[model samples]
Target: MMKKFSLLVAAFFIACSAYSQYDIVIVGGTPGGIMTAIAAAKQGKTSVLLERTSHIGGLPANGLGATDIATRGATTGLFSEFVNRVKQHYIQKYGAESKQVQDCSDGFHFEPSVGEMVLEQMLAEQKSKVTVLKMRQFDSESQNISMRNDRIEKIRILNRESNKIEEYTGKIFVDATYEGDLGAAANVPFRLGREGKDEFNEVGAGRVYKYWGGTEGEGSTFQTDNAVQSYNYRLCLTNNPAIRLEVKKPLKYNRDEYVSMIEDVWTGRHTGVQMLQVTEAMLEENRKHIAKGNVSKIPGDVWGIARITNMVKLPNDKTDANNQHMAFISTDLPEENWPWPTSSWAWRDTYAQRLKDYIQGLIWFAQNDKELPEHFRKAAKEWGFAKDEYTDNGNFPRQVYVREGRRFEGMYFFTANDATAVAPGKRPVIHTSSVTASHYALDSHAVRKREPGKVHLDGFLSYPSAVYTVPFGVMVPKVVDNLLIPVPVSGSHIGFSTLRMEPCWMALGQAAGVAASLAIDDQVKVKYINGEKLQKILLGQKATLIYYRDVNPADANFEMVQQLGLRGYLPDWEARLNDAIDQQTAMAWEKLSGKKLSYEAGKTTRSEVLKSIYTNTAPDNRNASSH
Candidate 1:
């Protein structure tokens, strides 16, 4: 009886060890998840970030190092800090004036290895509060999530390292995964594929066939269908002989899959295409100055790897090669990834390998296929894998870029309507509870395979958008309690196009992390956190809620200006932060303060006008103060 009692005591301790508890549990170590953990740590909360894969930084860590920011300063917060650290690494390693610095393009462009290193370095800073567990995937074999009503009690993870099932319980849960697997497992409501254009009034919604490089919305069709944008691996390639491992032909290479490229080459489809230069700095001075002429041929268009894909320069003589946006049959493989959101790990791996083989086979075909022109073949031969990147994974990117997945049907429906301005050169509709901002174009890749007479692949479109705010409600689901999903957020397909960018993901992740901490501290559900308080905490972290050409996170009046923007006040209309307030400002102040308070010329600036508004409008502005 004594021996049996001792064994029972030992088992209880072991079970406790297996069931780890933290303040927050975040799934997916993508930039969003990483930042979520970091932000939670900042708020004096402990979090456990579980990554299914070996590395954390997601697409940027893989090979999508070239950021997709049209307006760079629109996103700051932890993301800005991340890029600044990356830039500092280059400056420290190779002097600031070195050619490597120029290629990095202000730290936005970097090698895959450097990206992973910086992400790991960031995790190290918050190690005490943020625990990262890689190779721990959500167990989908059974009902893995323990939920009481709408709240997820705990999540079951299959530790690939230990090959054992484990449980993680937390005060708050965050679904940072691109696929939103955790939320799906918890039975949170989500939308899998495209919504009809009329469903959200999104121009490029549903089964749309849109053409590019011509008119913006010429010759298009919109219909309702369940289609997802293609997924591809962003190859980190290099022609530099010191680090070049020529792409080897996959074992199961098939010629028929790549035979279609011969037709593109035979015609002038591959020629005269706008040469997306290696880097913005590399754009010829003539092109930059817009030298117009009756020019028949463009420079760097005819041959080489550029014919196959678009290569953006990164530090240390490496290139982040992505799908050529114009090509229908480039890296993007559409129509097959619909099952990725709720598929088994075995299915995802099989799909992952399929893309790996397809890309490798594509490269192999370009190099060795006799059906191609000789000059083009030789040019393709010049490029190879960057040997320094993904060294453990055969000089290939470890992760396939999953651009879109299960979007949570949360409190807010952020759509294409929010991204584009009602009128040009003005801000979009402002959200008073805005937590972060992004300015990436509404760029969606092909959602269908090749179709005859379809000039552009079905569902491939890119349109520039105004800087926009993503509200705190975007990350909060309506039906679930104590859960926050930053990626695969509650937004439409067209809206996800711009929000899908990693910088935006990181910013959202940071907000989710901080929001999780706030929920735990206040003993409330994530949906019920004080809106003004959350925005204040984010501002304290140097996050930008609105884009101002003149004002920045560094400015003393940054938070006040952002606060004013939140109240639907456009002081100077052109984002002139220093400009004195006009009738618009006076009107906004009167609405907020309930008193007609007008400031004299030079006596009070726009910042002062906004400060007054923020103080009067906010229930408790103590936490919202910037100074």
Candidate 2:
């Protein structure tokens, strides 16, 4: 009897040793999570970020290098601060040839490895204010989050390393994971699907087809049919000559498995056609600018693309087309992601393996296959995968493509009406809420081909809404008081794409942190937090609270100068704004701050302004004091 009692006690101790907690716990150390931790620390809150992998960057560290930065409007406060830090890394490494300063105007391209370093540095700066626990997950034995009356009272977490269980009590919790695992563990009210047009009175909201570029057959149809947004991993290819890494076949390789999709390639209906067109467009644009005597990189042998490039160009130039395209038409990993984004380790792991295989196979195709042009084939070969980034996995990064998942059905759902066009009586909102304003067309891809030679495409509508407001209610959970999701996964599918830029994500993360801080300080529910009060806090922090339409002070182009009162990319509206805003124009406007400029007034050339900002002589306006 004594021996049996001793065995029971031992088992109980082992079981209890599986969970632990902190004041504010964040899951998934992606950029959003990093920003959240930094925001919490800046607000003087106790926070801990738990990462399932050793690396911090979700996809940027692995292969996603593009950062979707919509609107060239100057964003101050936390978002600006983050960009400044990223700028600093380029200065330290490349000095005179740094790409950071030149990359951002109407937003610029970025390399993935460089991005990983930038994020890690940002987190390290806030070391004292935040605690980061890498390589941790909530297993069955460790999955325990207790909430009391809409507040998280106690969170017991299992320390996998030391085999110990601990409890943490907090006033607020944030789910920053690309996959809303924490929200699932807490049983938050969430959703995943396209709301039929009948549900929201939206025309392009349901299944339809309207092609762009061409159809799947003609490379012209941008269609849709009850499809969630597409998802894809970003590949950071290089032709740097010095970096020559051989492409390896995925362990799960079976060439026969890709026959149908591969057949698309032979039949000239390959997805690579659109990719080539997009790439060629960029290369041609670069050439056109160079011909005009604007300083630009020559259309190089190698081209880089990312996850967000398909629909929106991230501030960094990534794409989300990995899973959006079906079979060989996209990244071909939707089936793999079916079980993913869940809290179940088994499901997550299986999906993880599939992503690895998919990405690897894609790379192999880009290198050895006849699908890609010869120039691209040679250029893509010179680039080597970064070693320092994505330390969590030997092959890929930590972030999986989370197109649409666990959208918390909050107090207010931002519908197409609110997003398509400004609704009547909707005032220029001033809220503690921080979300991105999207000017791009409401875009979605077709899931299935509608005809034998046609594809299902719809929602490529250009009717854009006014600068939509992302309310705090969108981030706040309806049932879970302490939790908030700011990655724009908080809103509907149409809304998420608009809000899914890196800068916007940064803005929302900071806003969420501020809201969390308030919930902790005032001891109030996130739902009940005063919007007016939140607006004050945001303005005080230099966040854009109201999207005022006053002629911004930054539109001083040479053509615009001649047409003072006129509103367009240029004063004359003669120049059709193309690919990217010009560097020379950007430089001049930065110094002018929207004031009318006479070409003769001041000899501050683009070179001079570049020198000033790059040399640190320009006044740094991203600091807290400026806010």
Q: lDDT of all the models against the reference?
A: 0.80, 0.53
Per model, state how many residue pairs clash. 0, 58
Q: Give the total clashing residue pairs for model 2.
A: 58
Candidate 1 C-alpha lDDT tens digits along 1-627: 999999999999888965598889988989999999999898889999999998888998999999888888999999998899889999999999998888888889999988999999999999999889999998543378888878888888989999998889988988888888888887778887788877888867876655554333434556667788899999998888888898999998888988887756544243122432233343443342322422113343345566668889888888889987756577878888889888988899999999899999999898889877666677789999988788899998889889998888888878998988878776777777778889888888888877776656778877778888888888888878889999979888888888899999999998998888878888878888867778889989999988777888998878777767776565333556556867755775687667667587555676676666666664434322111
The prediction achieving the highest lDDT against the true structure is: 1
| Minimal lDDT window, size 10, model 1 | 288-297
TM-score of every model versus the real structure: 0.91, 0.69
What would the per-residue lDDT of candidate 2 be over residues 486-518, giving only the tens digit for each residue?
763556666565655556666677777777777
Residue 415 in candidate 2 has what lDDT? Answer: 59
Q: Give RMSD (Å) of candidate 1 vs. truth.
A: 5.7
In candidate 1, stretches whose alpha carbon ends up further than 4 angstroms from where it belongs are: 1-19, 216-219, 270-302, 571-577, 583-588, 601-604, 608-627
